[model samples]
Target: MADYPRHPDREEARLDMSISQVWAAERISCPHRDILRAYLAGGLEAAAQDYVAFHLEVIRCPFCLANLEDLDAATSAEKEELRQRLGRAADRTVSSSAVFLERLRDSGAGG
Candidate 1:
């Protein structure tokens, strides 16, 4: 077996995705956090192609699709705030589900 040297400084370069492409990727509700994740995770070309299609503003309107870049710039506190918001949303959803289940039980529609 042969061993190869690895360089710790060798980090992958970032691709310049358009705002609209990022927006579409986001609006489409992909599982990953953002297109950058896809790019870094070995789908560089796919991510680039997605943005390239919208670079000319042909696919998505740039005016409405802007701000994707800034979406991930939150500080620790800001992230905490967002986490709290998501928690609240989840709590509300759970409460609603519980209420519905209770109603179903009351109506003898559930076991």
Candidate 2:
């Protein structure tokens, strides 16, 4: 059996009794779920969006399409939840001049 969760809407779904079941996720190989989410969020660059578009629209990757659909169908609460999750994942980088000066001095350059 495939360890990865298959898309219910995929061709194989015809054989799956869970076809009528509504799932929140799908297991796919290409254009990882994150990329799909980023694509829907419009966070991806033009080229990246183009690639995902090709994968979902042209390649017809059911799993990714399903993810995209889910993202598109997200409610206000769901969108807020996702926004919070992304906010928590952000990096806190300090780019103060003191930090740069210290780095410069360590590198034998004038601070």
Candidate 3:
């Protein structure tokens, strides 16, 4: 083999993704984070619920997986804070899980 000019940047870019990520990305049509968050909270509508299920079961998008992990890791304090922000005392129309994300977005919390 002959020595050739090497650009480490190009080489790094070519090798960036782990095999798992590449495989997952190939299959996943990842929905938006907010939508994923809503899905994680079990608040998505029927159509969105189907999409999320497909992503999780088939594509297994890593980002949504991480977001779901975060939601599962939510502390009691965090849940209480979300409930307070949504006025759980007075507003009993919706389940907290159903509204926590929307309230977080409205409060400039980036959901």
Residues 1-111, candidate 2, lDDT per residue (tens digit)? 669976667667564434223221343336777788788778999999998887677556677777778767774569799888777655323345668778889999874
TM-scores for every predicted model: 0.34, 0.42, 0.43
Identify the candidate with maximal TM-score: 3
Tally clashing residue pairs in candidate 2: 0
**Each candidate's root-mean-square deviation in Å?**
13.9, 13.2, 18.0
Give lDDT tens digits, candidate 1, residues 70-109.
3434334577999999999999999999999999999998
Indicate the TM-score of model 1.
Answer: 0.34
Q: How many residue pairs collide in each prediction?
A: 0, 0, 0
* Candidate 2 vs candidate 3, TM-score winner: 3
Clashing pairs in 2: none
